[model samples]
Target: MNIDTIELKQQQLTYPQLRKTQQYLMPARLTGNSGQPNGYDIYPVAPLGAGKIFTGFDTLADYIIKTKAVLIDGFGGVFWDKVQQQLQSCFNDKDLSVNWIYTETFLKPTGEIDALVKPFLGADDSVWGTKATFDLIDLFEPAIEQQVPDAKFDINIVIGTGAALAGWASPIIYLDVPKNEIQFRMRARSITNLGNAKVAEPFQMYKRFYFVDWVLLNQHKKNILNRIAVMADAQWPETINWMYQQDLEAGLDQLSRSVLRVRPWFEPGAWGGQWMKEHIDGLNKDVVNLAWSFELIVPENGLVFESDGNLLEVSFDTIMFSNNQHILGKHAARFGDEFPIRFDFLDTYKGGNLSIQCHPALNYIQENFGENITQDETYYILDCDDNANVYLGFQEDIDPSDFRLALEESQETGKAIDIEEYVQIHNAKKHDLFLIPNGTVHSAGAGNLVLEISATPYIFTFKMYDWVRLDLDGKPRPINIEHAFNNLDFSRKGDKVQQELISKPQVIESAPGYQLVHLPTHADHFYDVHRLEFDSSVTVNTDNTCHVLMLVEGQTILLQTADGTQKQFAYAETFVVPAAAGSYKLTNTGSGRAKVIKAFLK
Candidate 1:
């Protein structure tokens, strides 16, 4: 992804100004005001096993009145009141009592678990080792098996909050929430400090553990959603659409075009960059640096569907739940219905460098993080200052034990380790493709806006060193030397690092109007990347596999499908074409040459 964008001297609109403009242009929101809710009509995004999804208050009430046990699992921050009220209505309908087994009942008092292992354990491990916190089987199974009493009720509903995965009940209802929304609720509602009952020295411990909890919660949600019969958007008091996989497939068949873009969520971080804050319209600039744009992490991403010009947003998982053959194709066994690739922004432009980190190996990640896949990432430099560089691998020949000791000592003492003595630094240029497979140590240096494309396991980074920098909250970030050591492949050091990890582009295919440059990925990588240089337009085959694209260099362009349906994209704007969408054309409607990067499962 080439990010050598000409700095436009256009007036910078304030967040409100951009928002007002966007609101005026956009149609009526599909969210808010549940007017004649068409939800529950199609849900679970796909079919679960062979059983039918029994929904509607009356239907559930009738089932519950006669049923033995049921389990409903979701994030606690989502609509507890609405859930309770609706369940009560169902019980009131037949004058039948119901059993509610909330997993919160079994939580250990606060401070019982020291989750403050690291302030920045990447995305996955930061959520604490939840397995060590509590035993799911021991705490929330008896009730699931009907051994525990149901408060003298006819039916039992076990509300498993990441406490248990295999609930002893048929048809688990999994409620999914975008991660940004969860954090938003965390701030709006001062309910952090979860699982902590006893007093502690620092209040920020809860906040520190919050990220880890978010990570763990998401892992549990994703895993549980896999076995669920029905999936619902957890946004309560709003139109939570019921998604069914079969319906999603049928729905796609009907649409001539599907604009695939997740509602991007922004957050300020200690090492947040200024590029997004300055360039991305409608973003609040008054806050600290803009660090992360949760572009398309499905478990943390929601999809917006337009119905009669009403933009209703649902979980992105629904797209996968649809189980469209075109999306995954031959990779269906590996990724199943879940989308396998993730596209996000890592802005270090005029900001601090990302923590030196490496992801766990495949089997190691599965065992430790509960993710079947690992994060094999690539940084396509989108926009960068002339003096930008990326840190990768280890320098020369350093003692692994000494490196570990230095990192541990840095964590103990506030003394910053000389990072260069350990990690290799490479100059970063616009469109430079840096491959970071699993167990590879890497960090994007300052002054570079990076388009981070990788496998869908967004979390699970084991941050080894943080340059002794404190987080925005004035707290020291985490350093997971132990976990990093376990995952780090020492072979990804010295000269071999450049030879193998850094991608070199070569013209793979070309024509009069277009040229495709292959940005060769590592052999272990299951995905491929390419740069499409086009003058007017270039057509490409989806080959029954989904494609994620970004207008890295162009000012603007149109992505048109075979049906002539067009969606305009601008500089740095990312979008996906589903496998079922088949063939599409990218028309470079912008001035000058347009450079776009396309990534898909290999």
Candidate 2:
């Protein structure tokens, strides 16, 4: 099918109307007396009665004046100019003399930074970069110690990305911007990379940010998290909302031992679908199609906390930095600060097929990309049309060299090849689980809503073909034939696809009203999946591993943790029960049987 025909078909296809549930989009953990989850922009944090939270610049400036010296360190993409402007306005009439220090002044030269990051930024690839190992302090000059004045003014302030490196034993105010907001600012050309003075193209900038800037800044943030006196939400240009570090710690502690949900974000893509757009109530309907929902990708997601009526958000890593052992439990020793599992949605309903792709093997990823884990994925079909199909494995008589030549010719000549001749196709049905370990070729075909559960090191897909369609920007997506060729497992073809790649569900435990069915993942997978089908309620033990669950087959279910706190989750809503929670009970709140898919490290 051509692009125009696909577009017309997407517009004309009629979808089955599902019940619209608004709570799943912006799910939040209500702390203290907080009643509701704040809307999409602002999250809510309940007061812990520890350090005081400052709302406006005047109050923040008042707190600043009380201290002899203050350091403002934060994540990348913060509008430092706007921050300085607002603070200067707040301090204009004060009798105190202010001395300002910007950490950027002590940064290494641009050429030096570019050279330092060259190895991590792969050659001319807009989509990938190797994770860097350097710290934020390495980017700054050693003379930063001499920059801080010995003679203190009434108010001495140091601010910027690495301001904490100034070594001032002063109150630290950390400004945080969510990952989604950072990308928005990058797209608007309002923010540059950490040490750069000029903004580059959004795609290139994001590559650098992911591999270099964010890596270094997150380490810095983690190192100084305990020292921070206040955490500021600097997403707004003119105003700032901040909470006490002790309060944030309280929230993080609560999250570590309790059930929580990271806020999910949605994005549109060229091969996007109408499933999420029509079914998810709070999503913006103006977009052409919603392709992916970052359901529980903790690396890019944020946890929101509510206090009184005000809301504040911090990156998901903050929880890991604070309570890794509590959140991860037995897995903490191996994974450390990294949350090893990810769950997201791949919506191809009424859209196009995903690009034919395979992920790198564990050794290849570790040696080439410096990643600790590989992207071994599984596609659990949540919903699908009757004609839905999944492209997987390979044809029985596939020839590697001929397939490579055909792919290269398609890339050069813009001619489509018969993909089915070289690859295998399987009809997809709802609730069918397909294993896609590293080196397995697969794609979610059209008319399927796939819930992808996998390792956390995402963005390592090597696309072999893309059906000759241009992206939303009217540009061809990058093809990674060489990378795919190196990783693809030619042995996983023909009958082996059906015998091993397809998961078989078996009832492992059953009661009168509840049954726990094991959806056996591949032997290479480090995690396992179980489906809890209950007519009334079922209790589950954590078994000393974290549980990532989604309500897949029911309208709603109420989760009661061991701590006696209960929360309700709707269909397709993803939530996490920390390993410290011990055990939890799920009650089917709707009329039908509730099926919740739970993934835990095995």
Candidate 3:
């Protein structure tokens, strides 16, 4: 076919590939299951089939028509009505309908795999939302049989978690889209497979769409032309994913180019990419503008301990590159620079005592520590033993000498610090959140499980004491004895331990998650938190600027309208709701109450 002719029919035709066509014409051949008496055996399909297959379609319209878009409404997640309405508005043809399918009846996947949606036409359609989660190859194999029953396409859209890919064990299928799509899908798949085991971001795995763009579009195919781009303006995810892929392929050369062009610096101790300081000296400093910045902190690689301790994960600086790029492009549409979104993450793994230390006063950090010190931290306990305890602020007067003595003794004896003298201890539970402000003498006890969210750049850790855990090489880790001893604020001691309230948090007027009460200084960045209850919807205003919304309880839909355009965000398990999402409403449609937290810049 001529290029023009192919372009004309590309939309409707089964994507043209001579090799794929050959497989589509192959006969129904069963290899491993031939001897089975009955059809009760389950063949573990490859994630990406060993050989290519063909899909039958002649025109784009036919392709879309025969191609079903399965919407599996996972439990604990919500699909906004506005999103439905907006998505519906895009189609000028009135015949097309967006069907809302509830997959609640089928046994829900316990942890991560709460729901699964497969768009099946013909024979495959019956299985389309049949399971809470399923392997993409298995789901599509039958579809291929139904569509191109006589032939196979080299490329097939394999939908499922990363585990599903493993479940099928297919190897070497090239994904056409950006890496993040695969990452997101793999993330979702993992969660769904867990079923209902308190997995976070349950629906994230399925929301990502991966296709072989090279086979369809040219190398220079603009993202704006993608099907998803037609529906939503959030193209950064795809762009970022592509950049990540570029970095992977291009490596140091790309890094050099990035430095020369932007004079940018990566965060120190970065996890996925190179560390920050190593590349700082090579960056170009005379650029007209700096587009993005990433940041992170990594512990010494071989740090080890015999007793239980909390490991602190620091977000590398370059994180801003991702969060800011998205915000400037997406959030700026609604909340402008006035509302800068702050992104912070500490990928921590705890080992032993994180001294009973809290942040210094906000003013203290800003004035003494400099303008970029915002130390209010929120922890979503990631994993912890059943009886682990953390000593948050003190219950009563704790003599400085006594506290020091306790730490010294703990270090000397390799025992947990005597929290009884300085503070009361609360048994740490899984998924509980702790709001640790500056100046609060808190220590994360043994068996730590926490995801910390904080603001700004300053590591003012006035450690009270360390249980003298040795490093991996069997040497003792350093302790901040002088600093810890000097910074302990024994005044206004708080009730040592208090029960955590994880139930649908009480939402007040204009709050998104939890209200962390603390006064802020001029340079301090913070968000008023609110916990959203299921069934009960809340109307939020981004009067200040960008708000970072996290799903703490359940899934939520952040409906946004921009310049007469509206978008709905369903299955936002733990995704960020940009400040530009505008004056939107949050709804909880999951079986249980939705617990969403919103943090907006103030």
TM-score of each: 0.72, 0.92, 0.40
Give the alpha carbon lDDT tens digit for every residue of 1-602 in model 3. 00122322332133222111111111112222222121111111111122122211122223223444321111111112322343334332435544332122232333323223322111221111111123433222233222211113212222221111222222211212222222332343422221233433322222222111111121112211121211111111111011112222222222111110111122211111111112222222222222122211111000000001111111111222223333333434443212233333222222344545656565554444333344656555544666666667566676777777777777667786456666767677754666565555676665553445455333455655554554333555445545555455565364423432122234244344323322221122254454454455565555524445544444344443332222223222223433333455665544455555555554
Using TM-score as the yardstick, the better of models 2 and 3 is 2
**Candidate 1 residue runs with Cα over 4 Å from true position:** 1-76, 82-126, 130-176, 187-259
> Which portions of model 3 show Cα errors greater than 4 Å?
1-353, 361-371, 380-388, 409-416, 428-433, 446-448, 472-475, 494-505, 509-526, 536-539, 555-574, 585-590
Error of 1 at 340 (Å): 1.9
Candidates arranged by lDDT, highest first: 2, 1, 3
Which 10-residue span in candidate 1 carries the lowest summed lDDT? Answer: 38-47
- Relative to the true structure, candidate 1 reaches a TM of 0.72
RMSD of 3: 23.7
Clashes of each: 19, 8, 73
Model 2 bad stretches (over 4 Å): 1-53, 149-152
Of 1 and 2, the candidate ahead on lDDT is 2
